[model samples]
Target: MISYIESFKKVSESRLNDHLIFWAKTERKGKSKTEIKEQGLNIYNVSDVESLIDTALERGELLVLDITEADRTFSLSDDGKLSLAIFLTDNFCDAYKAYSIEVDAFTEETKQLPLSKMTIMKYFYRGHSINMLKENLALANSSNTISIAYHHHLISNFYGITSLEKDACTFHFAPRLYVPPEWIGRKVTIEIEGLDEPVKLVVTSPYPNKRYYVAGVKLGRLNTANGFYPVIKPRDSFPAHKELLLRWKLDDEIRIDHHLKLNFKFTNSQGRFFSSEQQLLPDVAGMKKFTLTTTIDHSTLSERNARVIVHDIFNHYEIHEDATLVNFPMELHHSVKATSYFSKWYKSWTAEKELI
Candidate 1:
């Protein structure tokens, strides 16, 4: 049996969910249905981008697949939902094929697992070979190559406004919008409650990739006393200066590329500042599971204080903070590799379903 459910079906077929295969966005949206009764899937091959995909998710996104050129450009369009295929193979289509015995064996082990609703859906996306799909996603991670193409989502609401105690104050506005590149360098005025004079802050940074702004600066003054973002006061005690690991399941859209500039920050228990902003680049983008990063690895942290409040900083406004996950870097992907294949029975396949 090729699938986990198929093996399970020998004992009981009724327990499995109907394997609904969607090849194109149209089919997923209910505009099309399969007319031909075939056991195989209806998937769009990597070379064929038939649908009008408006939304931009770049894994070397393409109107057509080109194996020769490694270069790509960023553009914005006002189109509807984008439906396109990302190449699982970096250079060769043959690379995505089952090349070794280890992958095949992994597929067998997976099929033997307990049958469940979640597990069944995973097995279906592995195409003919489950192991191949696993390797497909691991392609970029294993190579130590940076994700040259990606983007963050439209960030809405998650932001922090901090008063840097008379020295400087910070505010994040347009909390939900992707600030266009043109807006940077434009000047804006922010009204501070305590200060009689409105703080004149320039849009020094425009971070649209993460939806919210990644960083910002208050022009007037620097606070010598202290600077702090929101902190997650520990419920239990914290260990001494043991380095903490942090990971972010970043919006898959945030592409870490040569052109992309990024920064991250967090504070130690002592209220001392630390940054590993540069260390996160292509590395974060290439992470298999969660993006692996280290916090202030110092001995000064105490029971009530240690590493906390991690952020994926595009700027101050784009700060998304979370507690450190010690076991950082989850194994890439367990399943769900959407591969397109050109079936020999295309004539009959087209007759059965609408493909537009």
Candidate 2:
């Protein structure tokens, strides 16, 4: 029997050598093209040739090729050679070698374990490993199917339960189940059947008096319908403060009502002295457009220095000063774009400086 390590090593070495040869051929052809260009003294560019050479050298170092003639039978198309050269130059060969080594180690470690345990471990390992490979390789979705199948196999083989459904996308493992005692909840173990490996699921019940249900299991593209399952934790509370702004455009005359109310409170570091809620009505009517402004008053820092945050929901912030305390008004205005269906009906505010 071929040892796991030896099998993996053979595959990795073969791939590496094939990549190296492909790169070498591409580099040679590219150099010949450059030579012809140089001899003809034409304006033919060799930048692409130089880039190919660089790629070949990078990939060549990672490949381990045999010096013997029989092992040098690998062949690739011209375009394929160039692409392989680029892949090798980008250190993809090293990444694959690393992955192969990891896989070998994992296989060796799990060799003595029960087949069920080994399958689960390999499923998890391959899932994470393939995810890492995807970050560097733009693999097609179809390529992921193999890994999903492997995971499903592990689950089915380990559990003895035969009723498991494969997802349409072929990237998930789902197992369904139904149990009795609809009023008393209990922990349950789910096993997926039909794999060469072991797969099990452990679920805890949230309600002690109610019977638990297992609705479904979903992993990636794999979804299984088991039944309703108990949830251990409940949801949380809502936020106390949330500010939202809506913009509206006016095509014709309209009446404003008290229903248009802005309810909010503001406080400083000291306490809540400026806590006030009020409804705002349209002060201007029969106009082309106007903006509604809501200002939250903080507190007076000094006689001439009062801090107030003014916002109109859609537009930016504008800090204003009290003219009674200062001789001049110092206003800092910041504007934000309003994303509303009525934005076209509103007029843009004039850019100016005011003291507040």
Candidate 3:
């Protein structure tokens, strides 16, 4: 019994190694053997390999095995090998199940509980892990219905897309198409809607029809003259209102009849803002100065707002107005400068600052 058990363990380990090698071969097609080695799971040793087989059999976890007396080989029964495969598969399935449960629990918890962004991130991470486990398990069980289900589940959960297509045998994320890299021997995916909740697609073969690369480039950036600007001040100050100018520029493509508006609030030192938060001020509003000129048409652009804010130092409070809208004929380069007018009453009231 001891020898049988030992032999079974050895066989189980060998079988696992074989399966792992097969998996590695299919997974690392374009990758080098050295790269696989760097992934922390390369080849197995003779003795340790046997130990895995033994352990599985001892635990009655070996599902399938084959034993043939004619060949004078004492191997595991087919059931034993299958049992082991199922056992390994269970780890991933179990993780996915747990993830689903956690998601349900999170929904329930959040219904009555106030959760922070970090808490939501944790839930997302758990879902991501579940997706990864499902992906790996699908790779291990390729060509099997179980693998297909796993792939489908992962695609639906992470990428918000699912595939039941006839052409593709395997399930895939619909939003993303897998493309083979030109220079590198690995597969790359082009994301359509930026990286947020991006679609993930796997490329199994190197075919011209299976790959695509993104072309054309357009760039834009936001700029301001001074990072700090007072939106409100005392009534006695030099200027009764502050001016804030914003500019925009476009490259490559020309935009027609572009309308621009910014949403912003005046935050105090403690990050608090009062009601009536938005208003259209003259300096940034109106349709007169929003148009783009031909000189800075394609490569550069600029826009300016006059007296955008009023500072009431006597009241010790600032009134935040609505973002002004700028309508232009074409898109161009742009910049902004904000000036503040302070009142004497506002300055005197805030001068004697006291901690609350």
Candidate 4:
């Protein structure tokens, strides 16, 4: 007799019904109809997947059926349940090997068994020694074509911007670890902290989410988010009553030479906050430096550290947390055209005077 395990591979969910039907029909041509019916297997061509599911529910012997999301027949319960396996279809074929896993089944009698689990896998085994026939004829309950790597994931830390049309831009951002199976080929909406409109970004690729996974989204232009970038590292030490140097940049194209308000926050290891605000008229570009006297009395010889977050006065069109477009390509600004606006130098603030 042909081994059930070998027959199982030969008759997967796709051709399971056809193989059973053929077995019944071929035997009927030789034997009488009553003799063929004695095997106690009924074969029928159902109208849809739901009807096929109904056939399974009515008769527990009904084994396999292929289906999509359009419909469902019976919902599973405690007494009877279904194991939903999601897999990328191409991974299974005759030439390639299909993965097999053995799991314990839970039932009234086996409730106290050591390895008992709720999931139910019904099967029969017959063999001896190492060469045993293991038949695992199961239903193709679900299939996901997109292959996602579950083990490989990383929290990404980057944002993106792409130029679109006149006065309009597309901002790309991803929140933390973005799984490709859930993100790719879909449009999602997210609310940024400062931007007015609910931003929408399409996930273009999958990542670690870091191999440029970007977890980053793309937002179209409406009201841009507010931006606050620290230009220079604040002076970490206080020389009794000496100067405290701090600097910042804004992301607004508005050429305001008027003073704007800034609130600076500082926190020590215990998360206690010390805050102060200053008003200064920035240059044509929103950039400014401040040197103030502080009597907060800390050592100049020893080291002290504080966390910092700076907030600017409200600008309705502020581009939050991004300033790259403020220094746009020079060609866009020049009447005719100019060279690309590249960064003059790497940031060397608080470095040696010569480097500055």
Query: Model 4: number of clashes?
Result: 13
Q: Of the candidates shown, which would achieve the greatest TM-score relative to the real structure?
A: 1
lDDT of 3 by residue, 1-356 (tens): 22233233334334455665565456666767788768534434544445655675576645333344321123444555445334433534665456546644643453322222222233344455645534533443342332233334433433345653332221111111122133223332222222223222222222244332111111112111111112222222213222322211122121112222333232212111111111111111122222211121111221122112213432111112223322211111122212111122224334644332
Model 4 Cα lDDT, one tens digit per residue, 306-346:
22222344221121120111211111111100111111111
TM-score of each: 0.23, 0.16, 0.18, 0.21
Model 3 earns a TM-score of 0.18
lDDT (C-alpha, whole model) for all candidates: 0.25, 0.28, 0.30, 0.23
Best by lDDT: 3
Q: Which run of 10 residues does model 4 get worst, by summed lDDT?
A: 145-154
Task: List, residue by residue over 1-356, the lDDT tens digit for candidate 1.
Answer: 12332222121111111222233333445333453314223434422221212122233222221112432222222221121111222222343433323344553464421222223233333443554446543563553221110000001111232212222211111111223345433333222122222223222223324322222223123211111122112313222122211121123333121111222222212112112121221122212122222212122122113333323563122222232322111121121111111122233345654555
lDDT order of candidates, top first: 3, 2, 1, 4
Give the Cα RMSD of candidate 2.
Answer: 33.0
Displacement of residue 141 (Cα, Å) in model 4 is 22
Angstrom error of the Cα, residue 19, model 4: value is 13
Error of 4 at 128 (Å): 12
Q: In candidate 4, how many Å is residue 321 off?
A: 31
